[model samples]
Target: MDALFILTMLVVICALAFDFINGFHDTANAIATSVSTKALKPRHAIILAGVMNFAGAMTFTGVAKTITTDIIDPTKLEAGSLFILAALLAAIAWNLITWYYGIPSSSSHAIIGAIAGAGITAAGFGALKAEGFIKILKALIISPLLAFVIGFILYSIFKVVFKNFNLTKTNRNFRFIQIATAALQSFTHGTNDAQKAMGIITMALIAANYQQSTDIQLWVQVSCALAMGLGTSVGGWRIIKTVGGKIMKIRPVNGVAADLTGAAVIFGASYIHLPVSTTHVISSSILGVGSAHRLKGVKWGTAQRMVITWFITLPISGTLAAIIYYILNLFF
Candidate 1:
């Protein structure tokens, strides 16, 4: 096989691998609230999340197309397959590092930053498509803030509405409600997160001249969805613990509120074909709900630590990608 074809294959594998890791990493966020609230048993939650994620992944290609054509044009990238490969490698490395440490970092940021970094390294700063890049950054920054606001407001309303109700009965009712919300959250997670890998694969196809245009092929979608589904089954216990319990003591009511808030923000972003970090949105939702429910109950220390990690992920992943690109370029 020609070098280009081989490189394309490598990109496809790496992209799917990224999706798989993303599934377990972020799927934890989708189901953490439910599991923590005892709304679903851990095994049941994983199964539900895996199925929902697959269903959601197959539902949209708009975000994938955005990732493919935006950031930096695959059409204009020379030897771009190498850049993408380095990006995939860097993103995977960052994700694994965070996963090992149980930090709920953004896989979306890692890949996007890696792509930008690799592209910049290959062709300098001019390689970036400024408008699209800025738009994505806005979505990433704004979604978590939106999630926080919605979560705070929603839980405040819940408190007022259920104030007169029996506490035990209310928790029971909300626990049942959390089951549905968990599925919705996972579905929404699938809609946004799975598309990133799809975009990466499409970029590879274009860069290698295997395909033209930003349209995602059916096989690519199916493969990515399956990879993610399988990954979800593995579960991300460490990150799950941080998001589910360390952020706050999540009651069923609190879980439902956070779940609804995260689902709304994520689905809204997916509707507009924007990629946002599921980890950030979900974690922020919990923090918001905790603050609304009881300010002192919120773990500001843990929140501060997670926030610091979030701010650093972009630059760190980008720099790491640039470094990997140079090293990979040396070999190929």
Candidate 2:
């Protein structure tokens, strides 16, 4: 009924919508490898990823807390709901743009940068919580590199361990194993990615005086999880194709290695309450695995394109958010 409540409702709706988009956009991150290796059909992979993502989303809240307090404090935000709305809109816009072009962009970077951009626009650069903001930036920057290194190392170890085995038999075994790894990767993806929406919704609650502290409510978590699961069911075939085959010719063994590396990196970040891009980690892991298998086998052109998108997402999303915030502020 009141202006504040109306704005808060808008934020909740938009945040959930963003989460739904994220699910489909990043679905490839979880299941691309398995699908590429013929471990699962597209439909079956989507279903499995959807279920695992829901379970994982319901399992964590630390990352949600980080999103609530980091970058900028909700309590201190001026017209906080409007700021969040701008950020969500900007992020959603960027996401759709990338998805349409089939670029495996970072939703995490889009949202974080949007928040920072809108926050700075609303209250200037000083409004940001420098320490927490920098911490998240570091996590985003370091995660993909870590995934690459781990993927290279893990696959190299696999190569040594399986060298004497028959190639066809090894591929067959790894294909089956990829199913489990894909599920784990999806689960880990949900643990981190779904929480971003939960955090944004919780921030809206705090800003509207409907809640206290950064603790995520059960309803918020469940709704976000459901939104993500439903989105995953829709799938992202374009992205699946790109991540699965364009980056490299992924064998079953390579899929398993990348899945394991992605799962480990994402889960570790979630455990420490840092948000990392599932897209970046998964793609980088694949790149790492491909390089380990054969230096020239990895498609450097695709890798270069993805890396360019990654570096540009943050600044572009942030600028878009800033522009959106100013426009929204005029009305609200």
Candidate 3:
């Protein structure tokens, strides 16, 4: 095979690797509450989540289009294999690093940041579409807050509605309800997160002259979804422990509320083709539920640390990608 063909294969593999990392890293988002409440076993919850995530990927194509056409300037995407490989390598590296530490970092942001960094390094700032970046920035800023508000309102309503009911009955009902909420969360996860990998793979194919537009082929979509589902099945137990047991002690009621709120926000973002962080949405939802009871219910220090990490994710990934791209350019 020629050098170009080898590089194209490398880029595709790296894109799938990033998808796998995303699955494991974000598994905590869908399963944490159910696991913490003992509504499902850790292993069972992941299996359910993985299956739903795969199903969700088959349901939409809008978000994939947005990433391909809007995020970066397609015209500036030089027909080259080395550049695609460097960008995918940067994204995969950052994802693995964050996953090892059990950080629920934004995989979508990491990939987008990688593309932007590599694009800039290759052809200067003109290669980026500032408007697309702004849309992503807006989603990143607003989606979590929207989820928090929804969670607070929904949980408050749930509390009031069940006030006169027997506590035992209410708890039992919530446990059942959590199953549906978890499924919804998983569905939204598939719709949003899996498409991100599809977008990257499409972009890579376009960069390598294997395609003209950023549209994802059916095979690309299926492969991306399957990779993520398999990764989720393996379970990111450390992150699941942190999200489910460490952040707050979740009751069935809280679990349902958080999942429902997260699903709403994520689904809404996916509808608009904005790649928001499922991790951020669910974390904020959990915070909302905890704070709604009383401010003291939240572990402020742990939350503070997560918030700091959230603030730093894009810039750190962007810098990492830039350096990787610079170094790879020399060798290639």
What lDDT is reached at residue 18 by model 2? 97
- Model 3 misplaced regions, further than 4 Å: none
TM-score of every model versus the real structure:
0.99, 0.99, 0.96
Q: Residue 266 CA error for candidate 1 (Å)?
A: 0.3
lDDT of each: 0.94, 0.95, 0.82
Q: Report residue 259 deviation for candidate 1 (angstroms).
A: 0.2
> 140, model 2: CA deviation in Å?
0.4
- Residue 106 lDDT, candidate 3, scale 0-100: 74
Instruction: Give each prediction's root-mean-square deviation over alpha carbons.
Output: 0.6, 0.6, 1.4
lDDT for 213 in candidate 3 is 67
Scored by lDDT, the top model is 2
Which residue pairs of candidate 2 clash?
Answer: none
Clashes of 1: 0
Ranking by lDDT: 2, 1, 3
Question: For all candidates, what are the clash counts?
Answer: 0, 0, 0
Q: Encode model 2's per-residue lDDT on 33-149: one tens digit a residue.
A: 899889999999999999999999999999999999888887888698999999999999999999999999999999999999999998888889999999999999999999999
Q: Write the per-residue lDDT of candidate 1 for residues 1-332, one digit (tens) a residue.
A: 98889989999999999999998888999999999888999999999999999999999988998999889886777888999999999999999999999999999999999999999999988989999999999999999999999999999999999999999999999999999999999999999999999999999998998888788999999999999999999999999999999989999999999999999999999999999999999999999999999999998999999999899999999999999999988888
